[model samples]
Target: MEISEMNLFGREHIKVFKNRPKAITEILSDGVQQFGEKVAVATEEHELTYKELDDLSSIAAANLQQAGIEKGDRVAAVIGNRHEFPIMVFACSKIGAIMVPINVKLAMEEIEYILGHSKPKVIIVEQEFTKKVRQAAEASGSLEAGSRLFEIEGENTFSSLLEQNAELTEAAISEEDGAFILYTSGTTGRPKGAVLSHINVIHSVMNYKYVFQTDDTMKTLIAVPMFHVTGLVGQLLHVLYVGGTVYSMKRYQNEAYIERILKDQINFLFNVPTIFIMMSTSEKFQNHSFDFVKKVAFGGSPIYQQTFNMLKQAFPNAQLHNAYGSTETTSPATLMPVSYPEAKVTSVGRPVAVADIKIMDSEGNECEPGESGELYIKGPMVVKEYWDNPEANLSSFTDGYWHSGDLGIMDDEGYIYIRDRKKDMINRAGEKIFSIEVEDVLKSHPDVVEAAVIGIPDPVFGEKVKAFVVGPSLDPDDFSMLKEHCRKSLAKFKVPEEFEIIESLPRNASGKILKNTLKQVGGEKNA
Candidate 1:
């Protein structure tokens, strides 16, 4: 894995992997050449070997071409964690079309905005989501000009696209061409599409392979949504690059997931810490044998020490890794090393081989080693710019570095530790408090399953800390004990003045806790 420097898109000395697959489609072709008969992707109902994946995607691409999809056309998929998702990925890549994967859980307004913004030439949706997609398309006026719609399981289905008899013509696709337009969760404002080029995705997958030391023997389960970079680029594409097998889960269920792991002999696991928390606390998970698992990766949110300890116990033989990245970075900018000192457990490890990170203060000066600041990442994996928002592009990208909008600290050893999001950082009477620190401390309590901390408006202090906890029913005694637990670990001022118990935390499609949704909840004090 040699690296060479190239001046790409006005950025000088950008490092890229040499002699890699030039396009996303080439990944599948290489797999087909080496692991042709082996299953490339599978679900409960359907499976496709490398050869079938290549051949069927060719047919699908031909059908798309026949339906007038040409080079650089946008093909949006409002689908879920199905086999068809991966097929559509290759189909678009093969025909030089850009794939726009919309999170199925998004509201109609959000979906409409994405449809209108991206202006996809064709939208392939799942059966359950077709009506919503239709309404969104209509509202967005995307269907007025004849944007083709194909359902995954019904009439005018995507499966039929693979059966159509149309000659596939080769399109001139380049490594730098946009391969996917991934929309960020619109927590602060309207979602912006992060345009990931073919090289961005390929390099991300390569980084995972390099850091994880994974190979063709990998049997990974797609426990997360395929639309997400973690599942798509991190698990699916990474495994495919190594000529490994991928098992797709239509929907993630804890018990069913454990069964699938045992049934399929899944050896590699990648998911959010929340999923691992639930699985680690499950009785079924405790009874199962996970000795076959080689590596386990978790990210998207902070993990309490209790959860990390539980994961270690559950997957005794597996190496646990903490990853940190965003859609702008494709998937991983930083990955935990296989082994490190216990003191580095809280750190997100160093940046990937091709990634360069800078911690800059508010005044734009680079921060000292231990000082907290914004994390800016530049790498082959990082997307060059947002889809069509010039304002966002100008503000977000500076000299090829994508502003991560995340507050972090890099130690003298180069291990990066995420403090909080820049906007999510709480200023309490001029005292700074990172929500993740309080949330992690709260989750350390045995009775607390999960916790989220937010800054509530206050007259005295600029803002006061409030916590939302999802845990056992708390009596007066239990509440006091929980408060005591937090007081012992956190500063008195950092402890939540109010605590609310809820059934579960609201999350976006990516399994990130929606603090914005929690902020809208009335200030009713229960705990």
Candidate 2:
């Protein structure tokens, strides 16, 4: 099928969608009125019905106003998977504040950089992370005198702000207004904030609803972090849009995740491939009944064919889907059709109703079917631009399409199959690890002369980081010290899983490191 024909098919599919809300606040209001007594969100500690959610968000909005937050203000949150996170998100929407959800796994330096870049008016964090956030804010000079740092749970916490019974005076929020600023790591060793408007989020949610065929009866167990587009826009917000219930988990523990799936009778689930691999291979997974699950989606990293087959056998009643997207695309631009799982097992499936995907060559010309090229996506679900980063915007977007930097190909039927990456970014499990970022840290060591980082295939994690170094000492003891040095600056996931001493790194005439050669070397060592 032609691209235009595919798009028409998508639009036709979207035409049947009913009762769609224009903004986030409207979604909340509509949910409360329609699903009133139904549960909207739940965690291990508490549950909130739609009506209760509406009431609590109003209080939270009032609290935000009392705390001096104005319309268009940025509010950063460093909390885990909790009920209050969604409350804060809806509260921000009602007041026209931009909610910035920080990734809880980030190191102190990473957090400080985000706080400095976003310069939020208020920082809401869990009590455990309060000191770290405070320190980060202090270092970034974002914690000005009188700026509030509210904890998720504590004496003077987010709940304390809800004590006021004052009526919430709604701000004039528009569909075009920014709703979220999610930070995504860049290849340049810095994080870029993707500004997602209300429209962007709504379109993304619609994509999920249409692709997954979700409804009010659907119950999802959100194992992913809310800071990610998949968990927030795909699972959480989409569930709200359809008047469905969401069971939130603070963290993913294999056993705990399985228990919740069975106990909660979760019908919908979306997680990375690694989580599925762990669950399917576990002894407990065989004993439990997954009869309640209706849909299971996996993305962010490649799934082994063996694991995919095992999941199919494990959940015979559930529709297994493969999704493809990035933070810039909100959640998923493409979702494998449930009906064609076996036929298109390797494909990420076709573009969603609101999205348009194109494969372009280096010269910006569209590639023929089955021809590999960089994938570009255009849609309302795609982020407008990177927050305050003109350089990134200039390079990443062209002719209204966001360059995904992912190498892919499309078949005659419009299904997209991702082949490789155009950038040197590693998908370790589901975590994005840029090689340059780790290489910079490795090169910082005084004993190191030069460093090169490459990703090697792993059975559990999709890929593992391996470093090739040219240093003064090639001893095993010296390499161990180098690994320790990396641990001090980089996240544990980014640290090299294996180290090799090399006299020199192979480079092209332009002096660019030939990472392919290093990948081969690393592969041979693993073999």
Question: In model 2, which range of ten residues has the least summed lDDT?
Answer: 1-10
Model 1 earns a TM-score of 0.97
Q: Could you estimate the TM-score for every candidate?
A: 0.97, 0.79
Model 1 alpha-carbon miss at residue 47, Å: 1.0
Summarize candidate 2's per-residue lDDT along 1-527 as a digit string, tens digits: 11222122122222212344668898889898899999999988889999988888889899889878999899999977899988988999999999999988677888999998888999999998887888998988887745578887775678786776666889987766889999985434688999998877877787787778889988998878887788898789999999999999888889999988888899988887657856865688998778778998888765445557778888879988899888898888999876884767868889987677899998989999988789998876778788899999899887668899888889999999886667667889999776756776776676665677888999999999999988756666787788899999999999998999898777422123667778878999898
Write down the TM-score for model 2: 0.79
Candidate 1: lDDT over CA atoms?
0.89
Q: Write the residue-wise lDDT of candidate 1 on 455-510 in tens digits.
A: 88887897888888888665445666778898998999898887778889999888
Judged by TM-score, which candidate is best?
1
Colliding pairs, model 1: none
Q: Pick the candidate with the highest lDDT.
A: 1
